[model samples]
Target: MALESLDRSPPPFFRVGFAPLTKLFFFSALSVLLMFGDKQLQFTKPIRAGLSTLIMPVQWLVLQPGQVASSVGDYFQNLDQAQKDLQALQLKQLQQSARAQQVEQLLIENQNLRQLLDLKNTVATPSQVAEILFDVPDPYNQRIVIDKGQTKEVVLGSPVIDAGGVIGQVTRVYPLTAEVTLLTDRDQSIPVMNSRTGARNISSGNIMSGTPLIELKFVPASADVKEGDLLTTSGIDGVYPAGLQVARISHIERRVDISFARIHATPLAELKGRHVLVLQPTGIQAASKGKAP
Candidate 1:
């Protein structure tokens, strides 16, 4: 009875202010009233805007890692695409270079053919066109092979000439090709006449020891030969036609000890021609015509 009376009626510190249900109802009504006033008055807009502004930099910082990863991936993809495009462009450039070389070669060939045609109109003798196939394998002799042969009626000893002048003569004939001995061969000689004066001499090839020159062998020191005088075929040798170009006098040397003059001439024909004209032997043609009824 003493313990119950000590506590039950007891401490002022344990005294109550309000009931728990009453406190809960009063706070709930206060919150509803605040929400209704805020909606009607629109007073919280500036506060909401300030709060959003404060959160924006943090939002950006949070997204930075993902954005950097996407940028790195895109950079690598672009670099790979650029490398592929550069390779493609390089391949195209190589193809264009090859085609351009072929076109330039074709233009040069066409120009040579046109010049040959013009030369053909100027030739008076019966002639035929032939393409030079290749140079002969013998290095000692300056010779070349042509595409015309026995089937083309390319006779042995036929005179071969280029646009500028006489180049060679057909020395060997095959069924489909022929070998031409060029004028610069060591064993070749032609009877040439000076066009300025009527003097004549035999011009032999490679006479100055180791040079591509024709030496007028029998010319006297007192002969009327001058440097730069043009030489043409004398027509006495029935192999070549008269007045066809042969060479030009390049140098003249005379010694009191010798009776003959040492004369050197440069052949006017292009020895490295791609195309040539083969003239019918004048003697053979004349003989055939003579035998004709």
Candidate 2:
């Protein structure tokens, strides 16, 4: 009967409620101690390091799939963008090729005009069409380099022109390229003429602020010159051929004290653009004379 009573009474540990309460108090104290140690001291460094080392392989395993997916997505996007850029570049090249053909036709017509005038057969020198690689590295100089050079037989002193007018001349040459000094450069000069009256003048460039214009020196004050007259190369120097455009007169100031009149000419061409043509001087025409007995 006593054994049955003891069995019916709860087990010894459950009979004391304080035993479970003591275990709960001990667990809570352990958690608080761990939190305080982590926050206030480096006592858990070794444990943290060990746990990090153990978790590294798991982390790598977890991220591998996401990384591979991201890489594949990025590669495909880059490929698509590259294809689009290539298509755009090809379309631009085709358009430039068509425009080049039109320029060739115009050059042929210009040669025909020279033939009709019985002037020196202005042979448009066979030039290698070169792309303007970059502007002159020096900020003070207004110059540019082209793709053609000694390799392409690009000679020094070749006249550079554009659709509008003369832009510059090739001054320096290298193995794979050449440099062109623009007409607006301070040191550059050209022999020009009044297109309306055929009066010869020398044009020089100046770089002063608010007055960036080519100065026409040695223009006679008595010469019947007017504003807005076109200036073209005279071809006397044998560098640039006759009838090629140079610039247009912008301002003319005549002073009684000064013998020569001051004149400013605005270049007809845009110096910054890529398009340009290099011209070589056509040989001088032979003059005919009456029979000398």
Candidate 3:
């Protein structure tokens, strides 16, 4: 009986008061109340800010890989855009350079035309401007076709001159186009007078030489011809006007065995120009041609 009474009742300090669910509800309500109070009263905000500031570096470190990847992606996109812009700018620069060069060329041609115009006014023979239509396709000959022909009173045997001097003579005339045989042609010949001594010399084209050339034929070894002596039209053939420059003696060689000296001359007129003047003598007239079809 004494053992049963001792085990039947426990001490008050050891007694169970409430169920586990009731304790859980009480603590949960307390936690919710604390959170609401902290939010409403602005409590713990400074503490939160301090904690965030302290861990910022650690947070940044943890996210560094993602940031680096994003930065690398942006860098590649920017680089690609820069390369495309650079290529477009380079192409635009090339186009601008081409336009600038064309403008420069046109300016130079205009200056040349001005000089030719002044020369035309000073000369007595009436003339007209003619542009080179095209080069004669025969690779062996140095000849060009002019836009002016019988339609423009460009006659056969008409003298063609440039700013420098005689360039060629009209050999063939069409209704609206003409062929000018350059002085460098093998079959062409001109009568030139020595400006120094008034002596006559026949100028013939040099075909054997690779460069443009004119040779004086049958000039006696003792002839007064010298290097740098200017030659002009003698007007003996009436094809070219008098006193117009034809060639200048560049070199003279006299052989003891030969009777005449070999004379080489350089033409003053440059054949590379696009524009030329056709001179019409006062007495000569081109026959009117039938209208072009």
> Please, what are the lDDT tens digits per residue for candidate 1 over residues 18-121?
99999999999999898898899978888889999999999899999999999999999999999999999999999999999889877866776677778778
User: How well does each candidate superpose onto the true structure, as a TM-score?
Assistant: 0.70, 0.54, 0.79
> Which regions of candidate 2 deviate over 4 angstroms?
1-125, 283-293
Q: Model 3 residue 213 lDDT?
A: 82
Better of 2 and 3 by TM-score: 3
User: By TM-score, is 1 or 3 better?
Assistant: 3
Task: Kindly list the per-residue Cα lDDT of model 2 for residues 1-293, writing each as its tens digit.
Answer: 66765657777876766587899999999999999988899789989899999999999999999999999999999999999999999999999999998798678656543332332233344333456788888756788898888887777888877656788889999999899998888899999989899888888887664555788888788778888999999988767877887888888899999889988888987544454566654432211122333
**RMSD in Å for model 3:** 6.1
List the lowest-lDDT window of 10 residues for candidate 1.
Answer: 1-10
Off by over 4 Å in 3: 1-24, 36-58, 281-293
Clashing pairs in 2: none
Which residue pairs in model 1 clash with each other?
A: none
**Model 1 regions lying over 4 Å from their true place:** 1-91, 207-211, 271-273
Alpha-carbon shift of residue 58 in model 3 (angstroms): 5.5
| Cand. 2 TM to true fold | 0.54
Q: Over the stretch 1-293, how does candidate 3's per-residue lDDT look in tens digits?
A: 67766766678998998999999999999999989989899788999999999999999999999999999999999999999999999999999999998898788778778878998999878899999889999867878999998989888888999888898889999999999999988888999999999999889888687878899999899888889999999987767778999999998999999999999999999765689999885337322223333
